[model samples]
Target: MTVQKTEWPDSLWRSTAEPLRDFPELQEDIETDLLIIGAGYTGLSTALHAADAIEQIVILDQAQPGWGCSGRNGGQVHGQWKPDLAALQRLYPGSQFDAFIKTLGDAVELVFDLVDQHQIDCQAQRAGSIIAGKGGKAVRYLTEWSKFWAETGADVRLLDKHASTDLIGTSHYDRSMFDRRGGSVQPLAYCQGLARACHERGVTIHGDSRAVRISQNGNSWRVFTAHGSVKCERLVLATNGYTDELWPGLAQTIVPVASMLTATAPLPDAVVSTLLPQRQPVAEYAGVPAYYRVDETNRLVFGWRGTVSGEIGSLNTAHLRSRAVRLFPQIA
Candidate 1:
């Protein structure tokens, strides 16, 4: 039997994202104060923020800008990380838990502020978000989680089963935590819009210029691309999930896991009214987590964890849709 190569899934973001000016390939050696590798959210945001102080900032991407994980994410503007207060308390005790929690709340504000300041047209919605608790055990945990935030003056609240069912259009969940600052956006469009903003601020971004190698050259570091190179005082490797052996033991630190999502054709208004009516993004908290949102054009996009190399639209991998249908039978 011959080994057949599977084609990669086409991205929904690329189809909906605003047109971005194509960046030219880097062709010659260049010198800059800071060299940022990977022109996704991290790299672009770095260059944008450093523009006011740093005179020479350069960004290089292996592919087109924002063509990585930043463009492929669910676009939920969430504020918390995986670690809860209990976990942080266990890890840091009295040292950094408060600061960490503060940062978590501050992050959502920072993201929305950036979007407002730049006037990015990425179909952004600030209608809020919800984390639904699946099963009775998860619902108990959800109540505890909500209380943890509520006691700290967070605007979060615990929604009862009735409230959650009405809001999420599903009876599968009995509890949920509602966050006012939560929302969703066009992920690729937002990244593309940010690229434009960064470019306008004099950040030089080069596409199709993958960093082949990096090394210390005199007092500065040299980041080498296939056709070009950059000499800079500081080098930032922001190659997210695509990170490789460029820095020894760096990639191993992050446990890489793959996520897959499927989008339905634009649902009718009558149908959308029954699901995500207020446009709040909903994430299910259980083993093998899943999340979904009402994206632009009223398309209900759903996602879940899966194999790294599985093909999209495959029957074996289409469990997400089946699960989604089970949650909201009205979706049919």
Candidate 2:
């Protein structure tokens, strides 16, 4: 059950200059205390946290580590829950939502702490994040959201139209909210760092390994691949959007979405000094929000939501570039 290989994007931070490399394929049978299916952020973080406690741990990836979204994210490490506070309060009510929010905040701290402790060197910056407003309705929404976040002990400030223009150096946004809890990262490097840490902790990482067939053998489960099979007591399905065909109906509830990004040649230091001078990342509140950031080399990397066809193979870079120019006409 060999899987076709796909070329990963050449990340500025994860290319040859970086010290991490892809792991070898699984050639022999293996047994472990825990087996992690995906090598993305969630799976890698889980493995890293449990590495000290678990003696035998195995991480398997159909592709390589950081090949998926873990390497290809906007890298905005925002400490906010997926479901909004209102929705969480409505569903779980009272302390449940509060506890969830607190947990998410703690997770954000844990990510930074891990990076500092491991010395990941992923160009992590603790600047902040800006949610820019496009109109009057946007202003109202940001104001309300800022109030909600403030209640949760978040350091969020609502910037008026004038203040927003002054802060972002553009009149495109009518207002904005600044949240200090979020930051940017070189996502690919971060994932590679996690892989290295896992390896150092004696975690067996197998790349280019695809699980073609999975079956329950009485009390134990068998995960079959082309070269070998893993018979384990427990199995974790951590393949987010890429969990297709491996397990039937496993991703039925998740609507896989695609996003497109484009990077320009390294910008001049003068341009970087003037634009996003504070090194903070910016994202809009449009139906399809656009995110932009400056990499360590000062290159402008931007991306947006792509067409939703249940799957994404190739991305439309041209469209994303056009949007980038629209946002920062000076760069055009």
Candidate 3:
């Protein structure tokens, strides 16, 4: 199905985001120094970064900017490598591993730095992030992880049960890790702001212009869309989970997984003051983990694994509400 027919999901991010000017559809053949497919964070950020150096840059998206995962994610700015640090050290040489780890550590700053430099209006917060561990394995990992980060002179620490309860307003977790570098944002707004920043920098962006095909044109690359085409010296495919078969086997390399998020009605000021007072986003690790945070409007946005069948609210996320209530009886 074409992106024109897909509707925006009913999400809190959508309802809360300020209006963004829409980019026009591609209507004519064009040539550029760089052509990027997908206007999500990757493509937008790439364009913004290259705007000063590269003279001509063009970006195309299937739908409006941030219509994909960039808009609908949990918004938690987790500032660490997903893989185990020890495992990653074993996989790469010392120099490469050091560079990778440094990048991972500075990832959060890269995001906030962009937001600050561009004056993005996204509801960005840099309070911190908490990873609460319930069982023995999770606790041990947090303990070691905290020590590693602290040894690097990072503002990170492991909290006991009492301290965890005091910080998170919940007593369910056995121990928790707090990293001052992590935070959250209005993800959709951030994406749109990035798009606006790139556009203002003379980067051409076309929404509803899905890259249907691509081929080599001599030393350059040519991209075909429904109503237009682009010839560029270089092409970038930044479609993450929504990757299609534009490049034959490219889509097969990615395994698609779904996540669902639900938000509570805005709580009273009294209740909000007691919950996540420092505004740190929180995650709990048991078996199936859950991540949650307080939004700008004082609503609790809770997220977890979603069904593979592509279901939305109702039965698919009823258990999510129950679990959220279980964590904070005040919400009930």
Candidate 4:
């Protein structure tokens, strides 16, 4: 028999991120208060919160910590995916919508607080985020969106065509909005920092430990692995998109969508000054949204929702490089 090892991309945060050296195999059976199945942001964040309350919590991951989307995300903490507040109000009526919005705002704050308290040197920046509109229809849509966000008491300022050009130094967009609420960070580094913090707080993190099968005992659950098993009172399935065969029906609900990104060698100071004068992260609304931001080293990193097919793998750098050049011809 042979074991296949998974590989991760060479992200910018790979060097500075906290390293989780291999852990010894689970030789004997173990019982814990909670068994978390995944080592990404959600799993680790849940572990960090539940660590103080429970007596024992075990986090199981097939790969290394932060090996999934948690480490590979665009790092921008934007508002809800559904931009329409009215639809949200109608769907989650009463105080639910308000509570949801408040919770999102709190989530943004919590990310920053964790970075600060744990002293995570993840290049966390709060310069802000921009949503630019490329054409006539897009400009009108952005205008409506600005008005809608304003009604919800969100701090967003609509930039006219001239103003948008002045800000971005590109005449491609007719208008835009600056959302001061959210910003960007080195996502992988942040995840690694959270994992380290959880470990320091006595959370048992098992890496390279894939949950092969799961069974239900009388009242509890047992997770079987290639090396060992974990018997626990409660189980949390935090493996988003990349969920395995251990949990039935859980994987069907989540569509494992793939996204692609590219990072250029640090841009010239002059080009940076013109493109992103304020150094704010910019994202445009398209069928596939175009997201780009300047990192701490002033490198332009861009990504978008990738076309899904059969298998997911590392994105093509040449394709992404061409896209970047298309967006900023001057850079080419």
Candidate 5:
């Protein structure tokens, strides 16, 4: 896979995120108790958790923190797995399933807790999440989905057509499941905040220090980069979708899919007043896969699958624009 450059991409998140402090490139050979490759959420979160236990920890990334999917993703903090409750019960079995469900439910709360504890200013909002649907099939699925979560003490409700229309400012969806547990955030800012917390906790982070190779060195593992090498008793590979050949078969284990997003300029007051006035993040299962949420500036950021090549142009974003227009013609 081609490595991304050190420069950040032209994204709505990058344009709005708070400036991140620069980390130096690794230059000299070093040794640490733990070495994490990748500065995204996984790596940063791990480093933060391990800081109190481990004496020495180092994080290495090819680019600045939050320069990949962690920063570029849709900032929807939603819970619940893809499988339904029945399937999960069969898969996990008895008390294991209950523990799993509790974990899933607490996951969203954990995000807010971290934000409060670390004081991350990523525009964290707990307004709620709406999964809109249409037709009888969607209605049946969402009804069951809402019941499954509500039984576990989730603040969720099923909205009828009239209620869904009033909440979403569109009549496209006749039914929707609203859960108070989910919300939105400025993804890049959140990542930056995590990095800041890790930095303040004395977790050494090196940008532009891509791990090129890894090998077992007796009882320890040594990782090689362009300029330096690190030897650590514990090593973590947190490179998510950007996984490369550094670990041989690691990249092949997961298929990477490209996603694209486009944001409209801040809308007129009249349009903003009616378009997602509640400031809820929304996902639609009734049509093509799409998710959208309004930002602090009132721009509606819409996202969907992109081309396999990951190219961005008018041709690629036309669908996103059309969907937005269809939902709220007043914007056009």
Candidate 6:
């Protein structure tokens, strides 16, 4: 479907986000030195970083910047990915693995650095993030993970059972790992702020400019949209999960997975003050689905594995709400 007919999922991020900064639709054919597809965090960050270095840059999105996962993420920015370090090492050389490990820390730093450097009003809080582990395996992995990072000079530590439960306000997890370098942001707001920053830095960003086709045109590449087209010397495609038939086999490179999030009504100050006392985001590794956080407004949000069927909330809200109450009897 075209952007005009796209249906955006109803989300707390959307409900709470400030008005989105506007970007014009591509109305006329243009040429640029660089063209970026997808205005999500990657594309926006890429454009922002290259604005001064590259003379001309254009960015296009199907709907709007932050309209996808970048805006709807759990907003828990932690320094870990593909948690199996051994598997990663098995796949990459030692040097490559080391570089990758360093990249994780660099990633967290980059997020906050961008926020600070641009003064992005995205409700950023650098309080830190916690991963609460449940069973023995989860606990051990988290413990070792924390130790590994701590050994690398990161401000990370593992909390014992009592500390984990006390900090989480629940006696469910056996332990928790805390990394001071991690934090959360108003994800949608952050995406919007990034888009605005890129625009102000002389990058051309267009919403509703879905790329329908990409073809070579002489020495450059041409992108055709419903309303306009862009010719650029180089093209960067950052359309991850929502990748489509823009270029041959590009969509197959990524799998489309979905996660669902729910937010409670903002709790009273008394309740929020007691919960997440340090304001760190908390995620649980004990159950089927687990990441939770306190947004800038002190609303409790929980996420779980979601279905592409688009009925997770309709099907599971009751259970999720019950779990929420279970997590914090303060709500009940």
Best by TM-score: 3
> Which parts of model 5 are misplaced by more than 4 Å?
1-5, 90-95, 306-315
TM-score of each: 0.93, 0.91, 0.94, 0.90, 0.93, 0.93
Residue 269 in model 5: lDDT: 83
Per-residue accuracy of model 6 over 1-332 as CA lDDT, tens digit each: 34364456688888777776557788789999999999999999999988878999999998889988898888888887645567778877779989899898999999999999998988888988898877878877887888898889999999998988778788877888988999999899899889888878989888888899999968899999898999999999999888888888987777544566778888999998767877788776653557888777778887776554444444366767787888788976
Badly placed stretches (over 4 Å) of model 4 are: 1-6, 16-20, 307-315
* Candidate 5 lDDT over residue span 1-332, tens digit each: 34344887888899899898678889889999999999998999899989989989999999989998889988988875656567788999989988988887787887888788899999999999898888887888788989887887779998999999999899998799999889988999999999999989989999988899999979999999888899999999999989989999998886655677788999888889998898898887643467898888999888876444545433357778998899888878
C-alpha lDDT of candidate 3 relative to the true structure: 0.86
> Mind giving the per-residue lDDT tens digits that candidate 2 earns over 1-332?
55456467776545623765667777777776777899988888888878777777788898888888888877777665334446677987888876877886787688788889888878888887888868776777788878988887789888887887777767889888888877888888888888888888888888888777888878777787778878777677789888887788887867766776667888887676757777778888776678788877888888787556644554577777877777677777
> What Cα-based lDDT does every candidate model obtain?
0.82, 0.78, 0.86, 0.79, 0.86, 0.83
Give me the overall lDDT of model 4. 0.79
Question: Tens digits of per-residue lDDT for model 4 on 38-148?
Answer: 989999999999987997999988887888888887887765343555567788799887788778777878998899988987888887678887777667667776786
Against the true structure, what is every candidate's RMSD?
A: 4.2, 2.6, 2.4, 2.6, 3.0, 2.5
Error of 2 at 146 (Å): 1.2
**How big is the positional error of residue 234 in model 2, measured in Å on the Cα after superposition?**
2.2
Q: What would you estimate as the lDDT of candidate 2? A: 0.78
- Which digits, one per residue and each the tens of the lDDT, describe model 1 over residues 70-105? 888889887655545577789767758788788878
Clashes of each: 0, 0, 0, 0, 0, 0
Q: Name model 2 segments beyond 4 Å from true.
A: 1-6, 11-13, 16-19, 81-85, 307-315
| Residue 134 in candidate 5, Cα distance off native in Å | 1.5
lDDT of 3 by residue, 94-196 (tens): 8998787788778889999999999999999999999888888888888888898899898999999999999999898999989999999899999999998
Alpha-carbon error at 205 in model 4, in Å? 0.2
Worst-scoring 10-residue span by lDDT in model 3: 306-315
